[model samples]
Target: AQRVTQPEKLLSVFKGAPVELKCNYSYSGSPELFWYVQYSRQRLQLLLRHISRESIKGFTADLNKGETSFHLKKPFAQEEDSAMYYCALINGNEKLTFGTGTRLTIIP
Candidate 1:
């Protein structure tokens, strides 16, 4: 079975501090990883995906096969960045699994 785990349920950082949301997965075959963010009163949106190799909102994540991890990182945190982040994975069968999610809070 494929699964996604987000170690942190709640994370807080200073306005300009670095932010990292840990994500680990368990799967037998190659899976597609994604980071989804949901802002206040907004719908869930895609932040980034491993295959794209792109950075969004100053945040980037690298898929480490050996570690089976895809942790999201941002050099500097912004107040607007505060939101609920979910790590998800989809297997070859197109079955999607999501983590419990992490709520990020930015403190001034």
Candidate 2:
């Protein structure tokens, strides 16, 4: 079974500080990893994908196959960056398994 777990439900930090959102997954076969984000009232959008190796909105994530993790990271958090983040895994069937999600609040 493929599953994603986001240990933290909420992560609060001040603006301009580093932030790391933890994510762990379990899967038997090769999986595609992704990070999705939803701002206050906006639709969920793709933040980054392991295959793309691209960073979006100052955020980046690396797939750690050995540790079964894909943690999201940002060097400088911005107030506007505060939003809900979900870690997801695409299984062989192309079904995305999402974590409960973490609400990140960046204090100004």
Candidate 3:
């Protein structure tokens, strides 16, 4: 069995501050890691994936297989960036397992 863990349930930061969301996973085999965000009254969308090596909304995450962690980071935080972020993992069976999620609040 695989599981995703997000230790933080809520994160608040002032505008222009850096943001880092912690994510850790446990699985026996290789897994695909991803970060997804959901804004106010909006549907969940993909932020980035380890394999793609791309950055979205100024956010990026790197998969550390040895550490079994994938942490999302942003150089600067903006008000619009406030949202619910979820770290997920795709299992060998193609099933997506998501963490409880973190609510990010960017203050002015």
Residues 1-108, model 1: lDDT tens digits: 888999999999999999999999999998899999999999999999999999999999999999999999999999999999999999877777999999999998
Number of clashing pairs per prediction, in order: 0, 0, 0
List CA RMSD, all candidates. Answer: 0.6, 0.6, 0.7
Worst 10 residues of 1 by lDDT: 90-99
TM-score of each: 0.98, 0.97, 0.97
Q: Evaluate model 3: give its lDDT.
A: 0.95
Off by over 4 Å in 1: none
Return model 3's CA RMSD, one decimal: 0.7
Candidates in descending TM-score order: 1, 2, 3
lDDT of 3 by residue, 1-108 (tens): 899999999999999999999999999998899999999999999889999999998999999988999999999999999999999999878899999999999999
Full-model lDDT for every candidate: 0.95, 0.94, 0.95
